[model samples]
Target: MASGTSVSPNANRTRSGNTLLVWSLLVVAANLRPALTGVGPLLDRVQAELALTPAVAGLLTTLPLVAFAVVSPVVPRLAARWGPERLLGGALVVLAVGVAVRWVPAAIALFGGTVLIGAGIAVGNVLLPSLIKRDFPTRVGLLTSAYAAVMGGVAAVASGVAVPISRAVPGGWHTALGCWIVLALTAIVLWLPQLRTPRPRSEAVHTRRLPWGSALAWAVTAFMGLQSLGFYVVVTWLPQVFRDSGVTAGDAGWLLFLFQAVAVATGLVMPTMLRRARDQRAVAMLSSAVSLVGYLGLVAAPGWALLWSVVLGLGGGACLVLALAFLSLRAEDAIAAGALSAMAQSIGYLVAAAGPVAFGLLHTVSSGWQAPIMLMCVAAAGQVVVATVAGRGTVRPTRP
Candidate 1:
């Protein structure tokens, strides 16, 4: 994260100002969550065609998430070798390919393709904050807010259009998911310019302050993982959970939609507020506490789940934004930010990947929602400790 001691001659391609880069990043950001949320609404169509059972159907939804978790740990290593820009571009290609493969008629191929696609997304997901961290160092909070809003807005669009997109095609799920691949390609096209940026000197690239073996780095990564655990869990399984609690699928999806939609609004608001605080501990605690309220409400009063869904969504949404922002907040340089992002996202996502499956298994074993609901609370409580330590506001690797 130290300033560029220098740029490797081959590394610099098209040097551009931060303004243009931020704008470009925003465009990419808009594409982030759609590939994920878009396919969910069409899961039923997907299952029908494949003749997957209820459990396998659950795996279809859970597969990418599992892939996401599994792929995160390898991101930093990939970024280190390829450079963040190249890595980001490559990840988009992976996403496009993954989405494309979902349309293949074979079952093993479908699952394999899902893993490929999920892995691609996991790579891209970790890289974004690093891009923001490296490029918009001064505007971490504001830029983070923008990125968060883009994620939220796109998720809503994906959810809203999922059914419509599927209905438009006979092979609804295949085409609907395939549609996401196109978006991923577009993001790659926009990102092509970054890949052309000149690489910095060895000293800049290897500097420890921004990336590896740092306290802030670990904190940010852990926070990201914890928060994401809640968010993806809801995204993947919320509809089923609601239905089990007596809500119809339509009502349940709408509840999930509203939660994500409103979370987008809250996502924009949180970074500004969080930045103003000396440390992020209070913000993290509040975010987790609000999520707790939602979890409790949904469990105790199915009648009230609709209202509390708003609260839960808001907290989970903010958690995603905050976790990403930590890359920028903690890293002194973009490269460093990228490294930290890779680490946090990669590790954090793996942690998150367990939520849906574990929750499902818990439901099976305990014969009720109590265990899973309690698990969510415990996850939030753990955040309090991690966030407090992470939010201390001092930079690690101060030598840089």
Candidate 2:
């Protein structure tokens, strides 16, 4: 009776601790995309208010990707030295500050805060997989889907509400964008307990280098980059695309909302699909093909925008879940997962950083959306090709 009492208390404590960690992680995931995604619905207003050209306005989206590309490679080492919990906590501070600074009445503040926001998100992006691999090795697929769905759901909400929020609030778009800081602050509070936990010995003792020489690693990196490019391009430009096609700004925002809402649904279902599949290749190819067809449809008939958004959402959501799942699934352990994630995201985001700028430039130069939509079609085709290699059952070697 005494032993049972002792064990039960300890077990209860463990269970409660784990529950807190899971909620904290989900809150962190919720913060990753809202500040950035909120910008998409308000891009036209920002452009008109600032008297900016489309190409320069594209930079508003590209800047964060650049920051992600630049900062991601160093996160594993930072997490190793500071502990992932401490580093993640610090990142939330940066994200909160960035969101606040972005609300300041200066153009420089807008761009500069975006960089900080990107840097903050980059750390969370690279470390979450490692944390999951370390803490939930048996539940990687389910947890990945869970967080990915949270990301999509919150992102969709941010897009859908930005225009409405801006109108309702005093500061217009800036306030709409800045309101996400509340979430960042909430996440900080939820994550504080993690800072008190001690780092695991393995994480403290060794740091892993990225697997730059492995073909499989490269394949994963390409897959990550291409999928990100597609997602970011849609997030950055879809509202504008709809507006140009005669949709009202309000309706366009709702359309972007619809796109991400579908993505959230797809992300939630991905784990079941992944569980039944032999490997991820077929799923990857089929999703990519669906996205291609959607992009082609957008090019062929802008009137069918709603249909294409749903199609693109299905493909984008599946691809995102797979890309994140591959980070842990292909790695041998947590350390390897951290390294591979850093490698894939650093290079991957760099590739994605070019997408919005290029798309906008094409739109500006050609005076048509077809050319840019076609460019996305090419990217989707590339995703199909890369998915074949990245989706293999082969594990990424621990070291190059």
Candidate 3:
């Protein structure tokens, strides 16, 4: 029997509506990463002003991921009740407040505001794939590639520009931190167009009871989380890691830039390559290999570590982009995409939140950098193991 998926009279209207929504989603997505990733370069300055110990500084980075991890599980349900349009918009508004709050003189307010931004970002991360799935069903790989590429490009720009912006502005760290509020405002502006009608599908999702009762689904979700855990650990602390290895700050920062910038290319290219390959295992393994080599090089040779960091960045960037692609690949349809997004990110980010804190605690306890280096090696090895599982050509056990 033919499926009930016929072109009814309202089909064209639905298509027109969703197309405009997708474009707006892309704009919002571009802003999200820059806000989260931009803070790393300025971590030291923030610490100096606040009289923060290294442990406390690490918490600044860790808290956001913890918020991300904590908020992720409820995002699909939130989207169901509130709609992605509503949640996405509200999150940005909260993000703007969070950004503004960080500029305040008080440290308590700064930490509270940072948590709010992190919680808000958690919503954006889960919502994007759902938006892509609903609007660009036929072109998910391409569009996913676009967002990943844009995300990496923004991070690289934010990293490379953080010092310059901090130097140029009188408020230094405050100004550098507030730079992202403009992007948040832009998202709210673009997203306003999506808020006109009631989100009918989301209402249905709210009413329906979906179970998180499958092993394979959990596996895929955990796979996404662990890989991200490793990636953020690197992005958050890699520059300082390089600096400690005797590399100059200027060169070390550029290597950080290279990782993020090169990922833009990988983000654009990896999905296309994955689509052509029968299984993503080879690519996943190759990415892990590069990541391992990059880290090993950094640990083994401090002076010439810049090149390896680039390689590491390239591999890490590819891994993240591919993880996004997996959300689409394993979902049965759009609704499943949203559900998978919530599942993957909720579990994934919690796992990822450990990166900075763990690194800091290990360094603090050992009173040496060797512990963190070994920990990174272990994380990179875990990445290989996770990718091997996630790259397998199969959907989650449950059907949409």
Candidate 4:
């Protein structure tokens, strides 16, 4: 009876600890996209107030992607040294500071703080999958879906409220942009408990080098890059695209909200679909194809923006969940997951970083949205080809 009583307390503590960990992870996910997405809806105001050109305004979005690419390669080593949990808590601090710094009334602060935000998000992006693989190996799909949904849901809210928040607040766009600091601070508090956990072993710090030579690794990299490129391009410019089509700014923000909201819904359903599938190839291909159709529809008929947003959301959400899942699904173990994730995101975000700038430049050269969106169409088609190869059941061999 004493043994039974003692075991019951231990079990309860385990459950309690696990619940806190999951909530912390979800809170971290919530912080990932809101800061970036909030900027999109306010880009026009930012551009006007700062006297920035379209190409330069695009850089505001591009800077973070660049940061993600640059910082991602080093995260695995840092995670190995400090542990993912402690490092993630540090990241939230950086993110909070970045958010606060961005609110300062200087162009340099704006750009610098954005870089800091990117650095912070980059760590979380690479570590979350590895943490899931390490702690909940069997529940990767479910947890990935959960976090992705929360990420998308918060992103949608951020987009929907940016303009309204700006209008309601005295500092206008700065206030809206900086308001996300609260979320970052909250994440930091929630994540404090995780710091008490043990660090990873020294051997993990020297785990096999990144899967640079693996064909499957490159395919996964391409999949991650292309989907990220598509998503960022839309988030950065979709409001402008809608405004150019004669939509009001507030409504444009809501449309962006709708796009992400649909994505959140789709992400929520992905786990069930993943469970029933033999391999993810068909799902990947179908999602890419749907996004292709959405992009093409925008080009052919900008008037039907509402329908296209829904379609893009459906495809984009699925693609995001799948790309993240691949970080875990393709790796053989948690350490391998971190290596593969670093490899994929390092090269992938470098590719994605160019998207917003290129889209803005294309729009400048063509004098319309067609050429810019067609570029996305090409990317989506490329995704279809790569997703086929990336979605196979083959796990990435660690030594390669």
Candidate 5:
């Protein structure tokens, strides 16, 4: 029997509509990362201004992961009630407000704003793939590439210019952080048209039981966790690592920027690379191996941090892109994709939230970077173990 599916009959309204949709995708993708990555470069300034301890400073990064974990499970139900288009548009509006909320000079406001930002991004993270699965079903690879690239590229830009913007603007780090609101607001404006696009009505969807005990499911979830751990840890601490190694703060920010910049290219290309491979085990191992080498390099030589950052960037970028692809690739339908995504990210981000906090505590106790870098090495090994299985599994289609 044919399945009921909802699609926009006029999705390709005109040359103009197609162009607008593409622009809207890019802008929304661009909004997903900046609010989070923008804070990394400004962490030191925030810490000093707020008189926060190292552990507390680490929470700036950790809070978002926690929020992602906390909010991910609830997204599917919300999407069902509100529709993906309305939910996404609402998320952008909330994101813009969250960015603006940070403009007030208070610690409570900062953390509150971060929580809101994380919640908003969490919605986008869950919906974007499902949206791609819906609107660009046949062009998943290309569209995913474009989405990931824009996200990484803009995040790199945010990391690069954060400090300078802080200095040049009236409110220092507050303004630097708040500047992301403009982009979010732009995305919301571009996204409004999507709200007008008609969706076909269908019967109520029963919540499908997720495969909790499946090895492939566990593998996908673990791979997602480990990749997220690597990226969040590096983004949170790489600037500090370079600064401690005698690189100036501005240069360190740029190094972190370079790290994310290199990642943009890899994120853009990994999907095409995956499509060519018979199985992803070799590619998965290679990704972990590169990251392991990069982590080892950071452990052995702090002075060559820039080169190591790029290597780590390439590896982390590949893992992230691959993990995201697995959400779509491992599921056979939109509902299954939503279930897999919710399971992978809800649990995955809870696992990931530990990376920065643990690293910070380890650094505090050991009084060195060695222990943290070793922990990152362990994470890379874990990624290899999980991805080997997840990367090889065939898709399992489920119905609600």
Candidate 6:
């Protein structure tokens, strides 16, 4: 995180003019998760009203990961063609349309709109890091952490309010889901000025490509995927796990809300911690260790659910922010950063996409939560192992 170390060519470009652009980036970050998380709180109402089978209902969560994997690789190329700011603006436009389209009371529109929303988010996911690298390279650590907090905080709010918005809006779950269009629109409006600012030209400088053949790169990729998988597993199953332990559905829901709330704090703090550390191994190990304790605690004593949730949230949130930082930290320039983001996220999301389904299947096969819960513990340990290898300060020499 030292600006003097591996300075991206544009690292010197950070200045006061970025204040509005920074806020705009945060606004866009705010919209990225609401469309995804809002659906989870309202899923039961949606499934019953739409007469959806359990299998189909699951796609409501999985579609975003699918879109992320399918669209992420293409996003950098698209950004290369149309400036990142313009592409981000266009993606927000698509997100707005997608969020609004869900208002159409039909199953096709529900799934289709989710796909569109996911696709837009996928593009934003890849481009945002590169955008940060170009516009705020010197402040990468702070800006990344801040926007990450914005994204998590908005997601928590959306999840908490989705059901209430449904009741208040008259259209029930449909309106609840559609209400997020306001967030998307807010992003689009803020992002408009960025579109007018020309994308910086760094195309002429050819940095080495992403070090894909390096073991460290694969380690980083595994760390990203495992952390994502652990998070999605908790999000999809934690409430049910609590209910099985005799907690009421309402309180179980509150646990989910609490989880996200704690996550917002870690999202804001982890990058700053990473920036100050010489090597990230200790932070990485500590995060996974916290998650490990939480997983084991949930299995052994779900009665203390709130306590375990806060621990899991802290660890999971830290892991995610650090994974994001790896993309920026590992690469030397904007193009390399984009390539690394695309590589890590594309593979990472696909690995994560399997979490919910696999957990559900494991529960069904065992007729108990024990097996799936233990698998999560294994994943938490794996995170520590991979982070150790990936968190090394120096990248390996590029393969010929």
Query: Number of the top candidate by lDDT?
Result: 4
lDDT of 5 by residue, 46-113 (tens): 88989988889989888988999998888876776667788889888888888888878899889888
Compared with the true structure, all predictions reach lDDT values of 0.70, 0.89, 0.73, 0.91, 0.83, 0.78
Positional deviation of residue 294's Cα in model 3 after best superposition, in angstroms: 1.3
Instruction: Give candidate 4 misplaced runs (Cα > 4 Å).
Output: 1-13, 201-205, 395-400
Q: In model 3, which regions exceed 4 Å deviation?
A: 1-20, 201-203, 206-213, 393-400
What is the C-alpha lDDT profile of model 1 across 1-400, one tens digit per residue? 3453212232332455555566667767776677677655555566677786544655655677677667766665566556767877777887778778877767776787778777777776777776655544567788888888987888877776676666678775667666777667778787887777655444445433334566666777778878887876777667767777787656666777888898888887886687578877788778877888888777778677678778987888777777777776776555556556666776777777777667767877887777887788788878767887666553444334
For lDDT, candidate 1 versus 2, the one ahead is: 2
Model 6, TM vs. native: 0.90
TM-score for each prediction? 0.86, 0.95, 0.91, 0.95, 0.95, 0.90
Which 10-residue window in model 2 sums to the lowest lDDT?
A: 1-10
Q: Write the per-residue lDDT of candidate 4 for residues 1-400, one digit (tens) a residue.
A: 1111101112334878989989999999999999999989999999888999889999988999999999998898787688778899999999999999999878899999999999999999999998888788889999999999999999999999999999998888988989999999999999998888667555434444788889999999999999999999999999999999999999999999999999999999999999999989999999999999999999999989899999999999999999999999998777788888998999999999999999999999999999999999999999999998899754554442
Model 6 scores a C-alpha lDDT of 0.78
Q: How many angstroms is residue 32 displaced in model 2 relative to the true structure, after the best TM-score fit?
A: 0.4
Clashes of each: 5, 0, 2, 0, 0, 0
4 versus 5: better lDDT goes to: 4
* Candidates ranked by lDDT: 4, 2, 5, 6, 3, 1
Off by over 4 Å in 6: 1-16, 199-210, 394-400
